[model samples]
Target: MKPSIVLVGRPNVGKSTLFNRLTRTRDALVADIPGLTRDRHYGHGRLGSKPYLVIDTGGFEPLAKDGIMYQMARQAQQAIDEADVVILVVDGRSGVSALDKEIANRLRHANRPVLVAVNKSEGMQHGLVVADFHELGLGEPVAISAAHGEGVRVLIELALEGYPEPGDGEPAEGDSIRVAIVGRPNVGKSTMINALLGEDRVIAFDQPGTTRDAIDVDFERAGRKYTLVDTAGLRRRGKVFETIEKFSVIKTLQAIEEAQVVILVLDARQEIGDQDAHIAAFIRESGRALVVAVNKWDGLDSYVREQIKGALDNQLTFIDFARFHYVSALQGQGLEPLFHSVDAAYKAATINLSTPQLTRTLIDAVARQAPPRNGLFRPKLRYAHQGGRNPPLIVIHGNALDKIPESYRRYLEHLFREVFKLQGTPLRIQFNVSSNPFADKQAPREKRRERKTTDKAKPASGSPARPRSAGKVAAAVKTKRPSGGR
Candidate 1:
C-alpha cells in the first residue's frame, strides 16, 4: 500500500547498498560483488517528511540470460513492474552503457513514474563523466555518491513526489500527508517528529510537558508536501483529569482525530508502559492507522532487546496488524524504514481491490495450494468474495469449515501476498461451509432414518400395517357401535 519505490539499473550500481542505507538497517544482502541481490528484498523506508516502501531489486542486464544473473534480471524487471515509482540508478563512475539504454527502454514501456539516479558522483572530476548519462532520455539524473550519503536526500525528495495525492476530496489533497505526532509526556514524541522533519517546526525542550497545544507546520521534501502536527504530550491516568489539563486533553484528542495517521513514540531507554499501550488503544479506538515508533533505539543492547520488543508487541496482539519501528530520534537513525512502513500501512488501508482481479488472484492462489482438509471430508472451498475493506476481509465458503488449519490459512495468506501484492496490509479470512452441492440434502442416513420411523410407528408387531380399505371398515364399525352404546 505504501507507494513502492524500486531501484533499477545495471548491476553494481549500489542499489542494495542504498537500500541498506535508506532503511537504516541491513535488510538486503550487500556485497561488493555484482548481482549479489537476486530476489527482491524490500524494507520500509522514508525521506524528508514522507514514508514509502523501498524495494531493492537485482541489477538489470541486457544481452545476457545465460545464468543466475538472467534470473536476477527477471526478478528486477518484476519489481519494476510492481513499483509505483522506479529509480534507474546508473553508476556515475562507469557512465552509461548499452544495458542502461536497454533498461531505460524497458522502463519507458513500464509507464510507471520513474527517476534517473546517477550514483558515485563524487568530486568535480567525475561530474563531466556523469553528465553524458543524460542521453538515456528518462530525464535529468540525480547525481550523487550513495556510499558517501551525498545527493541521496535530493533524489529521495524527487522520488517522494511520485506519491499521488489522496483520493479527490480528501482535505490536504494538494498538501502533505498530515501526520499527528503523539505520545505520553516526556516520551520525546515532539523531539522525534522534529528530528525526522529536520527543522524546528515545533519547539523542543527537556521539559516533560512543554508542548501543551497542537501546532501544525507545512513541511516539504523534494516538492512533496507533508503536514506535521505536534501536540501536547499525554500524561498518566490517575493524574489525567486535572482542571488545568482539560484543554490539553481535548486538544490532544482533536489532534489525533484530525490526523490521517498517528505516530505513537515510545522511549526505548525505558520499558514500555501502560501509558504507551493506552495511547495505541486510543488511536485504534479512534479508527486511525497507528504506527508504534520506539524512539532512542540506539541505546538498546544486544541482550534483552528482543525481550523488550516482544513486550511492546504483546500489547498489539489483538491487532495482528499494526506497524512498529525502532528509531533513534536524537541520532536520526532507523527513520527511513519506519516512515516507509507508515506510508505503506496507510496506503494499504485505503486501497480497494477490483473484484475481477481479486477473483482471478484468489483462484490462482487456490490452484497453487489447496484449502485445508478437515478429514476425508475436505472443506470444499467454493469461491471467495471480498466481504469488506479498510483492512480488507475475504470470506471463503466451503463445507466442514471448522477444521481448516492455521497452516493452510497461512499458505493462502502467502499466495494472496504474491498474487494481489497486499504488502503491509492486514488480511482477514472467514471460512464458510455449506451442504454438499450434488445432494438434495446430506448423505442418505437421515432420510433412511425418517422412513424407518414412519414404518415403525404404523406396525404394532411382526405383521404389516392395515390397508386403506381395512381402515375404512374399522372406522365405519367403530362409529355404528359407539352410537348404539350411547
Candidate 2:
C-alpha cells in the first residue's frame, strides 16, 4: 500500500510548490498570494519503485474559529489525521514566524512522524536558514527550494524512510483472486458479497454504516478460487463519526490497495454523488482491476436506468476502462455476468506481453499517428517492454520522450490497450528517454592515447606521409613549389 504524505503549513509557504515537485505534476496550484489553496489536492508519485500518495492541503491557521480559514484549518487537520507522515513547510527566507511556531506546537502531539521543511531556500545558506526553524521543535529543518526542485528528493526519502518497500506487502493466499467490494454507505456492498456467495456471509442491512470492519471470506465458484473482501462503506469525511468509523475507512482504502481486483458498488437509486466518484477515482489511481456494479437495479424504470447510465458517462468518465454491470445484488440477478467480467478483468490485469509484441504495437501506433512535435524536438519512440503487472506497465524506450504530450501518451495507451485487448485495468506507460551517447566529452587520457596512436601509425621523421585519398594526393602533387624550390 502507498503511504500518504500530507503537506501542512501556514499560507503561501510553498506547500503546493513542494507538492508539485514531489509528485512531478502540476495538480497543485502555486502562487505567491496567501491562502491560494482552499481545499485538499491529491496526487500520485513514485520514487524509484516505491509509489506513494501525496496530499496538498490548504494553509493552516490553528486559531481560526469561524470563517473560511476555520474550514480550511479543519480540512488540513483532517488530512494530518489521515496522513502516515506529515511535512510542515515553512518559509525560510521569511524566517520562522509566530504562526509557524503555533502550527509546530499543534503537530508536536500528532503522534506521527513529522518533518520540517524550509522552503524557498534555494541559494541561501542551508545551515543558517534551517537554524531558525529548529526552535519550532518539530525536528531538524531541511532546506529546500520547491520551485527549483532542490532537496525535495531527500525530504521525501526521509519522510518515507521506515515504510516497507513496494511489492513487500503480504502475498495473496494460493491462487485466489483477491477482490474487494467498496463504495459509499448503503450501496449494497454486503448484499453483493452475500449474493455472490449464495450465503449470508456478511450482515447486509438497509441502514447506512452497518459494516464497521473489513471482512475477508474465502470461497470457490465454478472451480475457481476467490477471496472476497467486504469493506465498510465510505462516507464523506464531514459525516464520518466516531474513531472506529475513521479507522474503518482507512481499512477500506487499504483493502482496495491490497486486492487484485475491486468491485465498486454504486447505489442505483441515489444520484451519483461526489463520494462515489471519489471512491472510483481512488480505485483507478490504485491501478486495481475494476468492475463497477450498480446495485439495487431491480426496480428502476427504463427511463431512470437510462438517466443513471448517462450520469455515469458524464461524471465517472475517468473510469471508462472498467466494465459496469447494472445488477440487483439482493436478488442475485446479474451475478453470472458480473463474475465473468471480474474474471476477465483479473486476467487482463495480470496478463504478460512479449517484448516483440509490445514493440510491434508501439511501432504500429506511431506509424499510424506520430506524436506531435514539441518545438524543435520531435519525440522518437523506439521500443517497448513490460515493466510490471497487476497494473500493466509498458516501459517505452525512446529519444526526446520527455517532450511527449499527455494527449499523445493517452493515444499510445489507447492503442496499446486495443492491441492487447486489455480491458478493465488501468495501463501505465513509463517513458525512458535514452541518453545521447555522443553527448559526453572524451577523457583527457583517452584523447592523448588516440593522438599518440595516430602519430605511431604515421610515416617516420624523414619520410613524407602518403595521402590516402587519390584526390587529396593529386591536389598535393599539383601544388606549385614555393619560391622556385621543391
Whose TM-score is greatest here?
Answer: 2
> Per-residue alpha-carbon lDDT of model 1 for 453-480, expressed as tens digits?
9987886778786677988988988777
**What are the TM-scores, per candidate, against the unseen true structure?**
0.47, 0.75
lDDT of 2: 0.88
255-370 in candidate 2: lDDT tens per residue?
Answer: 89889899999999999999998999889888899999998999889999999999999999889899999999888998899999999999899888999999999999999999
| Candidate 2 error regions (>4 Å) | 168-176, 197-203, 207-227, 231-255, 273-278, 302-318, 359-383, 396-419, 429-486
Model 1: pairs clashing at backbone N, Cα or C within 3 Å: 2-344, 44-337, 45-336, 46-336, 52-340, 176-225, 176-226, 398-432, 398-433
TM-score of model 1 vs. true structure: 0.47
